[model samples]
Target: MSGEMTQGCPPTPEARAAQRARTLARPGLEAVRVKGRLRANKWLLLRRITQLGILALFLAGPWFGWWIVKGNLSSSLTLGVLPLTDPYLLAQSLAAGHVPYKDALLGGAIVLAFYLLFGGRLFCAWVCPVNLVTDAAAWLRRRLGIKGGKTPSAWTRYWLLGFTLVASAATGSIAWEWVNPVSMLHRGLIFGFGLAWGIVLAVFLYDLLFASRGWCGHVCPVGAFYGLLGKTALIRVTADQRRACDDCMDCFAVCPEPQVIRPALKAVGQAHPLILDKDCTSCGRCIDVCGKDVFRLTTRFDRSES
Candidate 1:
C-alpha cells in the first residue's frame, strides 16, 4: 500500500496532461462504438419483428378465411367486381358506364374515408394484403442473401397507376384487382378450391427466393393510391439533429428509401436537420438506425426543415 500510494501521489505535468487526454478520448471512442452497436442491434430487431409479423399474418389470414378477411362473390357482386372475378363491375363503374358512387364507390369511399381520418397510413403500414405478402417475400429474400434494395424509380408507381386507370377504362373493367395476388389468391381458393392459393403461394415463394417485394412498391395500384393520398397527410415523422452531424452517412445508408435520405442529408448541419418528404413511410427505421441519435419522430413541426 505504501509503494502504490507513493507511485500515485504525484505525476509530472506532461504525464498528467497525457493522462487527461487519454481519459477524454477513451470515453468518446467508447461512446461511438457503443452507439454503433446499439444502432445495429435496433435495426436487426426491427427487421425481425416486421418479418415475423408478416409471416404470421400470411399464414393466419387465409387459413381462417373469415368472411371479413375473405372477399367472395359478394365482394364481386355487391362490392363491384373487377376482371379477376368481378372485373365487369370494376370496369362498368370506372368507365362511368355504371354508378361507382352507388356500388363500387362504397369500397373506394371507405378507403378514402379511412385515409381522411388516419392520414392514409392504412394501405402502406397496415391494410394491404399484398404489402403483407411482399414484406414476407422481402424477409425471405434477405434470408436468401439479398441484403438490401430500394423501391424502383419514384415514377414507377405513377406510371402503374396511369396504366391501371387506362386499362380499366379501355377494357370497361378494372384489371388491376384481377392481377392482384391478394384478390387472385382469394378467388383461387374459393373458385378453384385452394389451387389459386397454391399458385399464388408458389409465386410468393419465388419472389421471396429471388426478388424483394418486386410487386408491391413498383406494381401495386393500391399503394399508388395511398401514396398520392399520403402526400397530403398532416402527420409526418422526420429526422432531427440539434448538434453538428459527423457526416458519417450512416443514416442515409440505413434508410429504406434513399431518395428521402438525400434531402435529409442536405439539411443536416444547417438550421433544419429533418426535412421529410412523401417517400417517408414513417416506419421509424431511420430513427432506430441513427447511431448519433440524430433522427427523431416528433410532432413539433419545424417549417425550416419542411
Candidate 2:
C-alpha cells in the first residue's frame, strides 16, 4: 500500500456544479449580453477593422486601380513614400545572400521600432490577413468544442525560425517564403486565389483539427521572430485588477496565448501585473471577456494596480 499509488477522489458535487455552470455559458456570453454586443466585442471589432483596412490598402492598387500601395506584404511603399518592410522577410533575403537596398533596410527598421514599442504579435492580432482566417477557425473551434488535438511545443516556432534562416542560406533562396501563409494569403487575394487558398485553408484546418493556435503560437517563424523582437515591448496587457477575478476562466478561453496570463493574474505580488511574455498577442480579448475588468492595455512601466 505504501509503495502503490492511491486512487484520487472525484470532484465534489459543488465543484461539479460550478464546472457545469462555467461550461454551459460560453466564454464571454454574459459579457456579450450584459455589456451589449458592440461593447463586448469592441476590441475584436476594432481588430477586424484594422486587419481589413490594411488589406484594403494593399488590394486597392490591383482591385480598384488605386495603386495607393505598391508591392505585397513582404515589402511595400505606401503612397510612394512610406516604406514598410517586414524585417523577418529581410532576414530571409539576407540569409539567401541578397543585400537589399537602403530603403528596404530603413523600412525594416521602421517596423522593428514600431513593434518594439507596441508589442509584436499585435501585428498578428491587428494587421495580418491570415489572422482573419485563423481567428475564424479559432472561433469555430471554441463553439464546437472539438478538442483532443496534438499539443506541439510552442518552442517549435523558434526552432522553425532558426531552420528558416539556415535553410535560406543553404538553398540560396528564401525557403519559408515558398510556403509562407501570410505572403501567400496576401498575394493570392491580389493575384488569384489558387494555391493561396489552399495555404490558408491548410492553416485554418491545422489550427482547427491538429492543435489550438498550433501555427501562430507554435509553428510560424514570423511570429517567433517578432516575439524575439518585442520581448521587452513597452506596451503590454496588464492584470491590474486581478484581485477582482472570480475564477470565471473566460480570459483563459479567449486568449491566443493563455500561457502568459496566469503568472500576471495569479502571482503572489500584485505589483507584478504586466503580461510580459513575448508570446502575448496583446489582443485585448482578456479585457473584453473579463466582466470584472481585470485586464487592460498599459505600458510595462505602469505598476499601478489601479
Candidate 3:
C-alpha cells in the first residue's frame, strides 16, 4: 500500500497476545477474532484501496470524461503535468531499438526512482490488475487445501525476463506486452480483451492448479525485472520480534514470497533483521498476520535484532 503499511485501528496488546495461543489453518482467522477484522486485514485493505484507486483514476477518463490520469499503467500523464511511465516498459522499448523521447525517459526515471526507494514489487502487490486475479486464485487454492501439481522453478522468471528482452530485440517490438496479463486486464476493463481474457484465465488456473503463485512468482518477466530492481530498495519488512515467533508459520502461509521470510525471522548468524531478499514483495501481509508482532515495515537501515 503506502510502504508505511501502518494505518487503521490496531487491537490491544492483550488481544494480540491472544493469537499466540492459537494457529488456524486459515491464515489470519485467529487474528480476525483476536485483533478484530480491520486490524487483521489492515495492510490487505490498504492495498485494495491503492489498487482500486489507481484503477478508478485510469477509468475516470474513459467513463466519466474526467482526465485525472491519462494512459494506463504502462505509461501515464497525470493532471496534464507529471508523466509517470513503467520503467520495465521503457526497458522493452530500448531492447526493441526504439529511441525514446526525452519526456518518456523522464517519466521512466521518475517511476524508477520511486520504486527503487520502496520495494519494486509494490507494483505487483498494490497496483497491477492481474494481481487481483492471481491473488483470488491463490486464496482459493489455500482455502481448498489444493496441493501438489507442478512446482515451477523460482528461476523461471529470470529466464523469462531475459527471453522477453532478447525477443524484443529480435522482433523489434515490445514482445512480452503482446500477451502481458496486466495490459490485457486493463484493456478488458475499459473495452473488451476478447480472446486475450483466456491468457489471464490461464494464469489463474496455473496458480490454482499447478502451484501457489505460479505465474507472478515463477513465470512473469515483469515481476522478475521488478524483483531485480528491488535489490536496493530502502523500505524493508523487518523481523523486529523474531524471538517472540512461536513457529506457527502463519507468516509463511500468508506471504506471496515465503522464501524471503526465514533470513529475517530466523536471523541466527550475521543476517540482519531486515528482510533483504529482492523477491520480498513488501506486501505487508506478513505484518498483518504475525500475531506476535514479529514483522514490521521500516527502513532497511534499521539494524535492531529481535
Of the candidates numbered 1 and 2, which has the greater TM-score value?
2
lDDT tens digits by residue: candidate 3, 1-306? 111223465545554544333332377765566678888889999999999999999999998999999988889899999998889889999999999988789999999998888889888999888888988998888778787898789999999889999999999999999999888889787766696689889999999999888999899989998888898999888998888766666888778888889878887554678899999988899888766678889998997874
Count of steric clashes across candidates, in order: 7, 1, 0
The lDDT of each candidate is: 0.50, 0.84, 0.84
As for candidate 2, its clashing pairs are 61-67
Worst 10 residues of 3 by lDDT: 1-10
Per-prediction TM-score to the true structure, in the order listed: 0.59, 0.92, 0.90
> On residues 45-159, what C-alpha lDDT tens digit does candidate 2 reach at each position?
8998888988999999999999999998889999889998999989999999998999999999999999988888888888888888877788888778778789689889989
True-vs-predicted CA distance for residue 205, candidate 3, Å: 0.8
lDDT of 1 by residue, 1-306 (tens): 011113336655565555444422222232246466565456446645664454343334456643232344214332124211233234434663445545445555554655544445334554334444555665456444554454456577678777777777787665576565656654554455355566567657655654355555455555666666666555555555635344444444334354666555565444455544554555555566454566666542554432
Candidate 1 deviant stretches above 4 angstroms: 1-92, 101-107, 116-118, 139-152, 185-213, 242-255, 268-271, 299-306
For model 1, give the 10-residue run with minimal summed lDDT.
76-85
- Residue pairs clashing in model 1 are 81-86, 81-87, 82-86, 82-87, 83-87, 91-172, 91-173
